[model samples]
Target: MTWHVFIKELKDSIRDRKTIFLSVLLPILFNVGLLFFLENVMMNEKVEQVTVAVDSNTDPVVISWLQELKELEVELVEDPVKVVKDGDALVAFIADADFITKLEKNEIPSISVFADPTSTKGGTTQDLISNVLTIKKQEYIAQRLADNNIDPLTIEPFQINIESISEGDDMSLYMISIFAQLIIVLAVLMGGLPAANDLFAGEKERKTMEALLMTPVNRFHIIVGKWMTISALSMLSGIFSCITFIIGVNLFTERLADALQLDKNIGFFTVSLLVGIIFFALLISSIQMIISLLANNLKEAQNYISPITTLAMVPYFVLIGVSVTELNSTHFMIPFLNIYALIKQLIYGIYDVTSILLVVGSSVVFIIITFVIAYAMFMKSKWVLGKS
Candidate 1:
């Protein structure tokens, strides 16, 4: 009898094009569009090239040095500082009049680099010019030593090396963590909403509720079957969301794929992730279904669910700026945030048995609680009979 109700509900949902679109096509389009926009933003944020203006009377070494640096354009100007001030150049170098003579005479000569410190582009260009000046100074010192019949290598200096003891240098986990919360939340809301509306308000509006109630099957079976159907449909959306993310990360962004640190044979891990998604979907669907059951009609349910959808995303946005190390066991008790933390841990390759057990145990407890609440709403005789 339960299977019959479940099959009937599943068939009805399949016939509804809105359910299919929300569960499948919507996630694909949204994920692709967001990734494309982000890729463009990352690409466009780069400093393409810097233009450095030098005074015509500047030493030849500095001019040659600036020209040799990659992605730099060197221009000889009558007044380098004026060129920079007039916005014709990012930065300008004004050399001392005694430039080469001072170097040859072993005297420290000062040159002025003109730039606006407040501007990002100007500041970046100035830094590049400053590095070039440092390198040129080192070259001048070497040349002076060679001219005096001394080995330039005799100047002693200690070498420093940097080696990281942690995992590889992929930082896209931060982006993936935020995106996981967003897509999973959206999948639950969008996928379950249509079905939730139909389960109560649609039946009430279409005048089909009395016939279903007249059937000999127990109310518990009817409610349980419908709840399973709603959870299944929501899980479909989660599947679509996961597919979209995997494809986008692996194909569109190598950095993100590396950050995820996935195993080549990810079958077991994938199954576990899908299981987590399904349980989360079950909880969200029950709440939405309960809300829909209380509303008088589909329009009322829509009005109610809109605010809930926004409320659902609040935790994700709050945690978007937060780091992994900052999160602790307390975060595991929050609704949406718990799932976020779980998925983040999975992505970063942290799979403590106790952690998974805690998340699954908490989820099962919430699922049972929500199911009881939704069933109570479903069994309301007055609401079911249109008396209220």
Candidate 2:
């Protein structure tokens, strides 16, 4: 409440190496490490090469179709079964020599694909073969329709284009949701324990808390001052980490643009992201402050905060496991859930005013509750004077 105390606390925080490290250095390291690791794992990994063996008596059409998948190496072998058994090929295709003749005569032709199901390449090879076979089957069906003087497209009456119409028209909304959720979790993890430590155990250990209580300052002012100090540090860490993430996203966006289906041209997304960051910072800071007030010492505070941080992360993981459209009002009211939902909406360019209001309102409510609890804790003689 007092500018002097606030300024003094800020100076102390800046001078505290532990606080500075947690608030700044740690977040930078975490963001860089995470981005580098993900980039290496996702972008640098080589595409697996598959080998397919076709029987000598296989139909020319099928053989040609196999060849079309040039990315996959195809070889003609005298015995398809032997090729598969000898491990010389990952997959073998055996087709009836008269398969094309039968198809021409309006008869169905069958082909057998063989591989060791337990083999390392089995799943990959099977998927490749299935994709090729599916295309061939579609082609055969289309040809049959054409032969009967019918249009295959007409038979499949309507084609539905499921376009996601978020406000910003960016498909990266889903990925942005995930990143937002992670940011919240990271904020809690980095700040929660240290904030708790400073407010409870640090005060107790310093022996300065009791002397402050004897001063003319209200217990509420003391609590608010301490709370503000820890929350400021926590918010600083959150903001730094978020800024790092945004920068990393911009740098990584080009590479992941196709995979994430992002519309990189949408600049308005930055505005929404900034708004979300403000709300998220306030929300987590308030929550951590309340948790810190509840603990009698640093160790106890950590024990209390750890589970809450984990609980906050649960909704994010749950959302990840489900579809975006499945998000509803219940999720909007949930703490971390609401943050992620709003972020997803923003990323997709769907900035719903009502959703933003709900998130802001909920955060305010939590902040009020946190302050109320902290006020009550501060009023206690033992907590204020640090006697017990």
Candidate 3:
């Protein structure tokens, strides 16, 4: 009877193509589209060149250096400050009248830089100018040391070497992991909502629950079957979300390769991640089903279930500051935080069997608790029928 109910509900769910599309496909499209847009924005930022305005009195050496830089286009202007204020360039450099004399006397010369620090292009322009000036200062110091018959290398007491022993140099992997986990969590909740509401609340509103109860089946079995149907839909949504997210990440892998370390344990990582998502789906499905059974109508059920997403998101924000290294077995024992922490661990290629077990165990316990509550509700005539 339980199997029969599950199949019936699932078949009914499949017939609602609009619900499936809204619950599953919409999230995939939104997330993947956002990913592509971010990729383009970052690529544009990387190759963007800034124009620099230089006063006529600027030294020829400085002008030549700026022109040689691939990131800068130098334009000699009568008034560099005016050009910058007029938005003709991101930044301007003006040389003092005695700049050449100061250089000959081995004294510091004044160079005025005009820019709007509030803008991104202006910030980049400032950074480029600072870097060039630093290099020139180092060169001047080396020349001065040579003229004084001193070894320039002696100015530094010790040589420093930097070695990166980690697989990746940047935090891009961490960022991607957070995004993927959030999407999966949302997918699981949203995917089952329509079916959950329709199975119980919709049936009640449509006057079908009484007929379903009339069948010679155990009330617990009937509820279990409905729970399975909702879980299946949630799992489907989560799986498709995972696939879409993975494809989006792969599309930008080469572009982000230098900043992100590719995980070599992808097979194990994927299996574990899907396991976490599946278990979470089961847990959320049971909860949503209970809510559906309690509501008098589909609209009421939706109102009750809507806050579940926000409740799920609150943990994400709360645990956002918690790093993967800081995660312990205790953290995995928690419900929502466990799956979140688990995803973070998997992204960094840490597959601790203990952590996985903790997450699974916690989810199973919650599922059983919710299942019991749902079964109890189903057995009662008042709750099932939403009576006063």
Q: Which prediction has the highest lDDT against the true structure?
A: 3
lDDT of 3 by residue, 241-356 (tens): 87777677776555443433445666887799899989998999888888988999989998987787688788788667877788888779888888888887877778899899
For model 2, the stretches where C-alpha displacement exceeds 4 angstroms are 32-47, 50-67, 70-128, 141-173, 205-208, 251-275, 321-332, 381-387
TM-score against native, each model: 0.71, 0.72, 0.78
RMSD of 3: 4.1
Question: Number of the top candidate by TM-score?
Answer: 3
| Candidate 2 TM-score to native | 0.72
Off by over 4 Å in 3: 27-46, 52-57, 75-100, 110-125, 153-155, 159-163, 168-175, 201-216, 244-266, 290-307, 314-323, 373-388
**Residue 113 displacement in candidate 2 (angstroms):** 6.2
**Model 1 C-alpha lDDT per residue in residues 299-334, reported as the tens digit of each score:** 988999888888877877777776666677767666
What's every prediction's RMSD, in angstroms? 5.6, 5.2, 4.1
What does the lDDT come to for candidate 1? 0.78
Cα TM-score of candidate 3: 0.78
Relative to the true structure, how large is the alpha-carbon lDDT of every model?
0.78, 0.69, 0.81
